[model samples]
Target: MGTAALVTGASSGIGRATACRLAAHGATVALLARQAEALEQVCREIRSAGGDAFVVCADLVDAVGAEQAVAQVIDRAGRLDMLINCAGAAHLSSFADDAPSQWQCMIDTNLSGTLNVSHAALSYLAAAARSDRGTADLVTVGFTAGRQSGPVTSVYAATKQAITAWSEGLRRELAPSGVRVGLIQPGLVDTPLARRLGAGPGQGLNAAVVADAIVYVVTRPAGVAVAELVVRAVGR
Candidate 1:
C-alpha cells in the first residue's frame, strides 16, 4: 500500500542504510544483493522496526541475473517506485600495480552492473511514475573520485564518472515522463568497500551521511527534482 523501492547492494553499506531509511519512511523495500544471508539479516532488522522488506539475491554483474532481480521485485512488491543502484566494487591501486582482473571487476560491478539493473527497471519506474506515485526515482551512488580524478582510484573514478554522465542523460530524457534521476557522489564512506580501498580510520564520511542525501533526493516534492548531489566530509 506504500511506495515500493528496490535497492541493489542492500546487503550492506549505503544500500542497506538506504533501504532501512526508505522503509522507515513507510515504503516497502525490496533488498537485492548477492549475499542471501546478509540480505536476510537486513530484512529482519527492517521487520523488527515494523517496515516491510523482501530479499532478492542477485549478482548485478550478470545481465540476466539483474533482469531477473528486477522482475522478482515487481512480482513480489507489485510495483517499484524507486530504484537505488548502490551495488559497486572498488580496487585502489596504482594503474601500473593494479591487475587487469581488478580493473575488469571494477568495470563489471560498478559500471556494467549499474547499467544492467537500470535498463531492466526503467520501464517499471516509468509506469510507477505515470500511474501510482506520479513521480518515480532512480538514484545512483557515485563517488567524489568520479568528479575529480585521483591516483589510486583511476578505474573506480572512471566508473563513477560514467555514472554521472549516464545519470545526467537519464535525468533529461526521463523528465517528461515524471521520473526523477539523480546521482549521489560521496567523498569517502566508512564501509567494507571503502576500507578495502584503503580509507583510514579518521578519513571518509559515514555511510549514513550518504544515505541521508539519497533520502533527500528521493523524497523531494513532486515538482522538484534534485539532479545531483555531492557529499564530502568536513576538511576533506
Candidate 2:
C-alpha cells in the first residue's frame, strides 16, 4: 500500500499545495479543514490528477474535533505515515490595538490546534514507524517571525515561537521511536492569509515554494531527518 498522509488546513495555501504534492508522490492524502466545500474541491482536484485523497472537515481549535479528524483519517486510510500540521491563522496589529478575540483566535488555531492534532496522532505515527515504512513524519509550518519577533506581530510571533520550541522537544522525544518531527519557517508566503496580514503583491514567497520544501523534507531518506528548515526569499 502507498503511504497515507494527513494534511491539516488542506483547503488552501500551503496545506492545500502540500496535499497535492504528497499525492503526486503516490501517497494517499487526507485533507482536513473547516470548510467542507473547499476541502471537497481540493479532494476532487487530487482525484482528477489520479491521486487518492479524502476530506475531513473539523475545527482544530476544538480538541475533540481534532481527535475525531485523526480518527477519521485512520478509518478511511487504514494507516497514517505522515501528518502536516499546516492549519494556522494570524492577526497582525499593534499590541495596544489588538483585540483579545483576535489574539485568542491566533493562539487557539496556531498553537492549541497544532498541539491537539499532534497529540491525537502520536500513537498512529509511532505505529506507522514500526511498520514497513520504518519512519513516520510530523511536519509543522511556522513563520519567520517564529525566529524573531517583530512589531505588530506579538501574538502571532508568540504562537510560532511556541511551535518552534515544542517541535524541537518532540523531535528529541520521538527520535528513538523512528518518528521524525520537522519544522518549517517560511519568511513570507503569497496567500490569502498573507494578504490578510497586509502583505502586498510580490512581497513574499509563493505558497508552492514552501510546499516544495515540505515535500523535500518528508521524502528524504529514512535515516535523514531534516529537523528544521528556514525559507526566505532571495535578497529579502
The C-alpha local distance difference test score for the whole of candidate 1 amounts to 0.91
Badly placed stretches (over 4 Å) of model 2 are none
Compared with the true structure, model 1 gives a TM-score of 0.97
Error of 1 at 11 (Å): 0.7
Candidates in order: C-alpha RMSD to true structure: 1.1, 0.9
Which candidate should be chosen as best, given TM-score against the real structure? 2
lDDT per prediction? 0.91, 0.95
What are the TM-scores, per candidate, against the unseen true structure?
A: 0.97, 0.98
Instruction: Give the lDDT of residue 231 in candidate 1.
Output: 95
Clashing pairs in 1: none
lDDT by residue (14-75, candidate 1, tens digit) is 99998999999999999999999999999999999999999999999999999999999999
